[model samples]
Structure formats: C-alpha cells, structure tokens
Target: MTSTPSSTHFLTIKNTFISTKNHIHTSLNTPLHAPNSPIWTASEIAESVHGKLLKWGPPGTICTDTRALQPNTNQWFFAITGQHFDAHDFISPQLYGKGCVGVIGNRVCEGWDNGFVQVEGNGNVNTVDSLINMASYARNKRFNGVLVGVTGSVGKSTTKSMIALALESLGVNVFKSYGNWNNRVGVALSLIGMDRNVDIAVLEMGMSGKGEILELARMVRPEIRVVLNVGASHLENLGSLEEVAMAKSEIFREAKLGDICVFNADDPLVSTLPVPHGVRKVFFGRRMGCDVRLVAAETADGGLGVRVVLEKEKEMVKFVIPSPGLHLALDACAAAAVATLFGLSLAQVGKSFSKFVPVHMRSELQVARNGIKIVNDAYNANPLSTRAAIDLLQSIACDGNRVAILGDMLELGSIEIESHEKILSHCCDSNIDLVGLAGNRFLIAAKNMNLNRVKNIVHANDAKILAQKIVKRLKFNDVVLVKGSRAMQMEKVVDAIKAMSIHIPP
Candidate 1:
C-alpha cells in the first residue's frame, strides 16, 4: 500500500488477555487507545449517535471489521448488518478475547457482556446510519481546518493526492482520503480518523449515481470543492452526459459563502455548468479566461512539461510533472489552482510537482527484464481515460512495437458497444502497431471495425487467455499498455507478461 509522507504513531491502550496456559497472569496487556483522551469519548459518542449504552467506559478506537483490529486497542465494533452477511454473527467470546472494547448494533449478542452500544432501530435500523451520524458530528465538532472535497468522473484520486502534496510542500499539516476511499462509508471513516492538528483536509468524493455526491458533500461540507471533469463514467446509472454533470455539480450544493469551487474550463460540458450564488468559481484548463490556464504541454524527460498561466497572477510558470500522461499534466494544473488559493506561490506549486508520485496502477510505468516498457493503468477505465492512456503510449519513445491491450469499460449503459468501438477507432488512428482486446464488449466492437482500416486486432474471451496469447507474441523492447475497468482485471495481463519474461533469456 502507498502511504503519504508522514510519521504515523499508533496509540496503545492496555487490556488483559489470558494465555493458553491456565495459570492466571495478573496483567495480559493488549493494544488499545483511550478514545476520550484526545479523539473521542463514550458520552460524546452516546450523545451523537442517540444510542443507549448497555455498558459504558472510556471510549476507544472505532472499527468495522475484526480482522483490522490492532492487538491491544480497545475497538468499538459496529455490527453493520448487510444483505449478504450480518456482523452480528461474528460477535463472540473470541472477539472479546481479542480486546474488543464494545459492539454497536441493532440487536444484543446472546453471549457477549463486555460492552454494548445499542442503536435505536425500529425493527430495521441500520448501524451504518448511526456510524455516519457519529462521523459527521465528530467532523463538525473536532476540527476547524480548511476542507477540500474532490470529485469527477476520472482523476479524482490523482488530483486529490497532488493537492495534498502541494499543501504539504507549503508546510501545511494535511490529511487526505486514503487510496480510493471516496464513497459514503469511506468518507465517514476518513473524517472520523481526522486529526485535530492538521491545517487542511482533502477528501475524494466518488459516486455511481445521482444524489450520492450530495450526501458526501453534506458530510464533509468542504470549503473548497473541486470538480475535475465530467466524462462517460457511471453513464449506466446516470443515463447521459448531462445527468453525469448534474451528479458532479452536487459538490457545490453545500458550499457556503466565500467557498471556492474549482472546475475544468477546457471541458465543454463541465465549463457550462451553473455555479450557485455566493461561491467563488475558479476554472482550470487550456482555455483562455480560465483562472489557471495551460499555456503549453509537451513531453519532457519521459514525463510532461506544462507551462501554465495563472490568470490571477497574470504570469506564466512552467512545471515538470513526473507522470507521463496529458491527463496527469492537466490534473497537476488543477492541483496548482487549488494550492494558489491556500497562499502558495506558483513557484512553490511548481517545485512541489517534483515530489508527486503517480498512484499505483494508474498510468504507472514499469520496464520488464526483457527491456519492454509497460504502462500499468489497469485500475479503472472509461472512454476518456482509455484515450488518454493510448495518447501516453503514443508519446513514449519505444524501441519496438507499440501495443494496446484494452478490455471492456463497464457501466456505459446503452452505449457500451458504441464506446468500445470508438476506442478501437482511436487505437487505429494512433501509432499503435497491434491491439489486443479482452471482454465481450470489445469483441463486439472488433466485429464492427473495418479490418482494412485497422489490422492486427486480437480478441480473447478473458484476461487469462488474452495474457497467454499476448505473452507469446511479445518481444524485446515492446511497449505494452494494459488498461480496463475494475471488473476486467487487466493488470493480470501485465503480471502474466512479466512472469513470462522472467523465465526467458533477457
């Protein structure tokens, strides 16, 4: 797992545990933290959640899964009941033995007497609701730091990371959402873990349909809301680009007076969205009149050199983004715009890009032992992102053939077939020598493609078969790009090719 640059200290609380030997050990210390000391208190939790405490003591850390609990930490396990599995079934003596401080649920566990926080559910009260309520209350009460909420169809995580790094460069203590934890529960938990000492908090808000972003905005109530770009993501649920724009526009709904809302002015759909009154709207992109405009972008040192014009400053500054995608350069520009609002100079923002690390599996470049360059962007995909990846592949200096291994971009609704076919045409237009496709949608798209216009197209039933066929055809110095949606598991192809190269003579 990738971690931010910081010193993380885990507070330990003492708990008594019995060893396998029947002999009574007076003190068996288990790891736990006193929640009320600086973080949270039992009474505060009870008040915030409006729950009856069956057993009350000092509040400990909050947890949702037993597997994630630390050894001696006093953890309050919220037995979140779901359709597939109820956490109530996992509550037992073993959990208590493992230093569980308490359990919050709708029903009482039969054999547990340690500690219980029972939520008032009128027969079907969800513990998750209580969790969210508690988290929102904690965020509202605990911190007064600058809060930034990032949302978009693509690049939310990358842009969030960039903004955090830029703030950190200015010596601001920063807290951001971990990995892709951008959903409702994830945002709640992230807010709950927020430290009071930080100067700013950057949270990524992601959704699959309408109203989800609105709910997240209500929870964070961020003063700085960033909508990166509106794209084809979640079209299956949102129906169309207009609906997607509306869903993303919800980030601005909870913005108060004097809050800053950042948008991408280069995108026709995103630039046209109406901003609510009383909020400052700042746009970032290549277009004129944008608050942060890209003057020029070019390939530099295997990465991207971006010359940006900060309209507020009325000056042009150049920055070298260490990532090799035009999309990444644009994300850097967006991050720079946010950083400038926090009082960082354009020079400071440009210098901060040197420390930026591309998130794993998101256009991360790797060279195998066989000297083949691999672009691993298999984390997730849409038509827009796939085209960006292909553009990155085309820009690289490849000694051998340039190959694109694409898979189905799911959740496109009625346009799934059309989107896949469009991606094939894009590859044909690019400088790619061969295209390897996986998934049923890609197969359908391949059948519709004009073989005369674009030859050397291969289709496989699945990722494993696709990897098998591609590995046999791969040679030294081949530049291969593996990308698809999460369900496609396109990373397996990169793994397969690397494994094959290890056994072959370099």
Candidate 2:
C-alpha cells in the first residue's frame, strides 16, 4: 500500500510471549541486574520516569494484556491513569489472599497493606511515561541488538514485518512490535515484552504530532532508518503536508552520519528532501535515480512478478511477491535496499520477497461465493493511499463489474472534501461500475459527481444502511472494493460482505 508523508502513525510488536512466573520478590532491596531479568535496573527505571511509588518490592510479573491481567497468580498490576479502570480496585479484591505483586494507581483504593507499587502522577500521561521508562530500561538490560525504526504514512507495518520475518527465517533472533503498537505506550510495552535473546530489534514509529516520532526515534537510535514514501495523512494533527514531510524526515534529522536513511526515489517529496549534514541517504523506487530501482515488473496468479535491475550493479534477477500491487513491489524494493545493508545478497533478498504476503486488511484478495472478488484494503485510508487502492481496483477489473464502497478519509483536516472529491473524480473515470458512498461529507461529494454518466452510484448515510442495500445489489462476477479511514470502521463493510456467504478464495 502507498504511505503518505502526513502525520498519522502506527507501531508494531511481535508476539514475544513473556513467560509468566511465580512471584519474584517479597520486600524492597537494592535492584540488581540479571542477564535474564525481565525487570529493568532500578537506576535505569528511575532515570526516565516520574511516578509515586505505590508499592515496589518485587513485581510478581508484568501483565500486559488486560483480558489476561490475572494478578492473583503472581504478577504486578500497574494502573497509572484513568485510561483504564483503577488496577487497585481489582487488585485487592481479585488477589486479596493471592501472592501477586500489586502496581496500583494513585487514585483511591481500599485494600493495600503490602505488595502495592503505587504511583502518584498526572493521571494518564505521567503513569504511562514512567511505565514506558520501565519498558525502555528492560530493553536496555535485555537485548544487545540493533534497533531498526520504520515510519511513513503507509506500509511501515508491512515493511517491518517482512524484514523481521526474513531475518527470522535466516536464523536471526529478532524482536519486532506486535500489531500496531507504534505509540509511546505500545513501544514501551513492546520493549518490556521483548525476549532477552533477540539479536535484532525492529520498531515501527507511527506519529501524529511533532515530537512523537522523535520520541520513538530517540528510544531506538536505529542503526538504519527506513522512510517509506511520505504522503498526505493525519493532516489534521500535523497541520500541513510540509510538516508531515518534516515530521517523517526527522528520522534523517536524528540519524548519525554513518547511519543510512533508505528513501523512496519515486516519491518527489521524499526524494527531493535536502539530505541533512552527516547522515547518508539512499533511494529505492522505479526511478532511474534511485540507488535500487525496479527495472521491470510482471503479473501472475500466484503473486506479483518482478525483474529488478539494481543500479551500478550487474545483478538482474526475477522475483515474485506473494502479494499483488506495485505498492508491494515498492515494499520489496525497500526491503531489498535495507537487506543489502544487513550484508544479505541480492539473491537472498529476492528469496525473502518470494515468501512475502500482504498484511491482513491491506490489499489482501478474497473471492466471495458466486465468484465475486474482494480487495480488503481496510487497514487504513489516506488521499494518496485511497487513490492507489482505486487504481489497483481499476487494474484488477476484468469480466466482473468493479465497485467501490467508500467512507470518509479521516484526519485530512480542512481539505477532507477536496480529497474525497479527487477520489470521486478518479471513480468517474469509469473504472468503477458501481459506487456506494457513506458518510455525510462523502455523500456531498457523491452528489456533486456526474452521477448520471456513471453506471450506478448510491449514497448511504452509514455503512450498515448501505451494506444492507449492497448485499442485495451485488451480483455474480462483481469485484467490490471496501476502503475508508480507520475512524469510519469500513471493515464493517468487508464483514457485511463476508457475511453474505459467497464462495471465498482459499
């Protein structure tokens, strides 16, 4: 998928399961670092955090998943703010007689005689800050590794996963984020959740504000930074496109002279950025100027067919991605670009691409019963990404009818309508056979479109209302494209379509 340079961001945390164990401490003692310790050093934890010590002797164990927050079994329950129900409320009641380490909040609580790590702070912000501090401290003590930060408006998560999986396949012990845990708390928590033996650390830095990316970047101090194409996204928060570019470019700003900044050569905004003093930069894309360029690409049923001819090198080899779209091709190029720096051969990198698959809900293809094709690009929405999705939909349209069920793209700020209108214009080009528009603002743009010229255009105020109508309207050989900003919850449309029980592609 195409990523914008604009501000909205997401993080990743791999499934690094921390082995839950019985209680480890009973009373306070000078903290000591252990090679296999999951808890941070006392000094390291104190250095980056500020919180009231509710109770700290020995945290039985750290419980990250809320549903799995079983403190009675021996674990420290940390409640820092109002973001969650007070951990103290459940601590005493749930583990009244249990051997659990309690990490309760500063708020009111009744039961607490011993085993409570209470912290007083400005509710949400301070508690999380300190918790993250603890996570960072744990990471420092835990892993002796290289930190790789991936950011951009799009494809950060997928790129991070591809590299991590490839590294893992090569027998490299790696620690990457799980899901979209790219935020401050997520990053901190992921660090705490990290396994001690990880040889490489991959973190996705998703940002919406000015210093957010910087915060993660500082924590990572990556040996290498990958800036996927920057486009317009989260414009509401970052304010302008330039600011979005600057925000993402902060990676280069923070990178040391010897560190490499991998960029998208096809992206004008990213490619044109004046490289800051000291940091080395390399470009990857379809452009001739790119250090690593896609010489040619073909298409096949199993995957996307590609023939990449690296510039200034004699290597020209064919590769096939498990996923479709030129976007995936670009992602492979970016992965190949970074893999080279990691001492991987071009052939080895090509082999890695051979096993790649689209992260779920990101242009993943599924065929419903009755031969209807569904392209699920529902993970996110942005002006550039939406356009790219539409283009992909258009290219995939064949004997089947092409349909686009869209919702409002969020965080576009003042230009939401114009952005929506631009996509509408693309639909008007006739690649789309039917158009279902949800959201009031989206409806306005649909109404303004040349509806009569298009074969079919329906405006639904909400997804369910529109989904019910489309369920009856969709026919055999129809290709439906469901896309929208995360706020729109457009995945509901994908679900509604799936609920129809059409023959699905395996």
Candidate 3:
C-alpha cells in the first residue's frame, strides 16, 4: 500500500522548495513571466485548488484574460464565468497551442493535451469558486509578508495607492491591488498575485452590501486595517449610514491581537467604532486626538500644501502633496500614519508625499489646448466625494470662469433623490459660474437651486448633451470640474471639452 504524505510533510516541502525560488527580480523591462522567476508546479497548484491535473508542464504565470495571452511564456489560464459572460466560450485549441502550461476549469478545451486541470462542480462548473479557491490556496502557500486592508465609502483606491507608495519609499517590496479592483474577485486576485518575495501587500476591499468586506477580510487576513471613512456610499442597498459603518467595520473581523487598525478621527462615524480587543488602533485626520493630524491645508505651487502633526513623534511636518484638493491632503495624513506603524519616520513619510500621484480621473488636473484647466474627478462618486470635489473646484485659483459638470450619484437606494438635492446646497455655496447637471436625480436638484446663487445652471439627460453645453460656454483659462458616479460616465464631459479646445502651443 502506498502511504499518503502528511500535512506537515506537504508544508515542509512547500516551505523548503518554494523558498529557494521565491526571489523575483522585477524591473521596468522585466516581463511578468521573466526567466528565473518562481512559479507553482502542476502538482502544487492542483493540491492547492483540490483539482486533478491531467497534463504537466513547466511552471509559469497565471492569467484570466485570454486577450492578454503572450506567446513563448508559460501561462496557466483559468476559465472564469460571470453572470452574462462565460470564459469557457472563448477557450479554444488555438489558446492551448500558444505554449500554455495548462488550463483550469470545469470542462476541458477540445484537442488539448494532458495540460488541463479539471475541477468538479455541482451540475455545472463554478469557475469563480474554483478561481477563489485557487487564489486562497496560493496565498496560503506563498504569502508570508505583512498585508494591509483598506476600505471605505470613498478614498479606498486613493488610500490604497498612497499606502503602497509610502511603503515602497521605505524600500519594502510592495504589491497593491491594481487600479480600483476592490471587489471580492479583485481582492482574491490581488492576494494570489503576491509571492514570498514581497515584503508587504496592500489590498483594497470594496462592497455594495453588508458581509462583502467580511468575506474579503477572511481571504486577505490583513495585519493592518485602514478604514478611511463610512459615508453614503451603497446607502441604497445598506439602507442607512449606521449600516454602512457596520459593513465597513467588517474589515476588522479577522484581525487578531497585535494587529493595527487605522481610523479617520475626523469622521464621527468612523472614530466612534470600537476596535477589536487586543488590536492596536491609530487615528488620522484633522481632529486633535488623532495620531496623525492635518493641521492646515492650502493650495501651493499648483498642488496642495499640507501641515501635519504626528502625535507619536511629537513633531510637526509640512509637505506638498503632488495632487490637488484638501481631501487628498487628509489622505496623505492617513497614509503617513500607516507608514509610521511600519517603522518609517516622520521625515521619511513627508519626503514620500512628493512622490504621490493621484489615480486617473480622481481629481487629476489636465490643461486643454485652449488653456482651459479641467479637473477630472469622474471616476466614481458618492455624496461625500462629490462634495469634496466641489470644494476643491472652489479652492483653486481660476483666471477665467469656474464651471462644474455634475452627474447623478448612483446606488443611494431610497435616499437617491434626497442625496441629489443635497448637492444643490454645495453648488450654491461654491460660487461656481456655471453648473451643468446630468441624470434624473440631478435634474431635480437643479430645480431646487436658486438661479441667483449659481450664475447659470443647465440640466441635460445624458453626459453627451451635458458636455456639449459646457464646451460651448467654456472660456479661456476656465477651470472646469467634472464629477459623478461610475455609472454616470462623467468622463465623457471632460473628453468632449478637450476635443473642442484648440491644442495650445507646446
């Protein structure tokens, strides 16, 4: 009779053999599947995901998008299926012929050799479940670095990027969730991408309902948890602000003793939450008691100048955030607090702020050919972020007119109308020259605003029309702010304005 390997034996083999191959040397020119990089063997992957491997080949990089398949590289493809699309439909012999290491899915592609791993499913294949299982398995077997989890109604992406950059400045090999991939699948993929070579991994967790963050937390098990704030995001499904706080707090569910939790002290909803027992808590914001406090913020040298007080060091530091907006300055403070926990000094953290880059479409400034300045913040929005963008628009010095092209904030649930109308007050207070409103909710809000408060207010049914109206009215050196929810597609307004402007002489 053959004896099965014990769990201890498996772990020992994984640690001994994998550790020797885990040092990955990545550079600007290095391909993801560069030579000498470590990859999981067929048996390791099969055992991790509990699937049966039929064919074996050299270890390679894992991929989900077939369009990104690269020839001559050892690629393992997963056939992930979604509600409206199934990756299985795209599987072909041609893909397998592209020197693929193997394919993992419920069904095998036609004419493929033994290079396929079959995962059993109930009735039909649940590729998503298989992917998640594989990711969890990989994370368990390979990842031994510190993990940080970031979540909130807004600023999850920005905070995640800032924290990752700050850690990288300290010479730590850091990996972060790409773009705004903060959902469950995105989080899993991000964690799975981490190898033992990484010193730290920053994962952003996003959700549309309760329990989502908890699920992600269980997968990531981050040692450091940063909760930026809890606001009106996903209020439609969650029902109330308190419920939103409850959901955001779930990021701490899997945290244990000695773990660190960062909170936004300026946000009453976030500051009042009780931290898990035995978990160390750090706070950042404009509040007096915060571990990192934003003393003051102002526009300086075409960016944001922020004065911060690091309470733990009992010192004050001033730095220029390479991004616009006071909200971003606060985000820098949050990032500084996280870096400090990782043993970075206040001076080191302050120096790193200058390297911070704003995520695309999130308060990124662009100058048009006509010398008009555009603040593109149309990536995503909720009531809180939209208000912050409006405040940023008013704070900047404009040589000509100040215009705002607004769109509906989606997923506000029953409070959608109330939330849209609430923005009118911000418009009235901003002293903006013209406001172009889009979406049904914003149309209603525009009616509530006093015509005298805003110089001109125009409502459009869609982004294309709103862009047209704003472009016709834009003047030289006018600073236009474009912001809305993801579903609103507000970036169209910025594109439209850019297309209309004459290219300025370089």
Query: What CA RMSD would you report for each candidate?
Result: 9.5, 8.0, 7.2
For candidate 2, lDDT tens digit of each residue in 388-468?
A: 788777766366578988888888888887888888989877558788887887876666764523448777778878888
TM-score of 2: 0.82
User: Model-by-model lDDT, in order?
Assistant: 0.77, 0.66, 0.76
TM-score of each: 0.87, 0.82, 0.89
Q: How well is each residue in 1-506 modelled by candidate 1, as lDDT tens digits?
A: 11121111100100011111232111101113223223456776676678888787556777777776666767778788766878877888788766687877776567677777778655668777887887788778887667899999999988988888887755545677777778888888778777666557889999999999999999998878899998998999989999999999998876776677888888877877776775677888877777777777778774433333343446666767776787777898889888877656777887888667778788888878767788899999999999999999998877678999998999999999999988888998895898899899988887776542345777798898999888877877788999999999998998997876434453
Model 2 / residue 2 / CA error / Å? 24
- The predicted structure with the larger lDDT, 1 or 3, is 1
Give model 1's TM-score versus the native structure: 0.87
- Identify the candidate with maximal TM-score: 3
1 against 2, candidate with superior lDDT: 1
Worst 10 residues of 2 by lDDT: 25-34
After superposition, the stretches of candidate 3 with alpha carbons farther than 4 Å from their true spots are 1-38, 97-99, 302-311, 448-455, 503-506
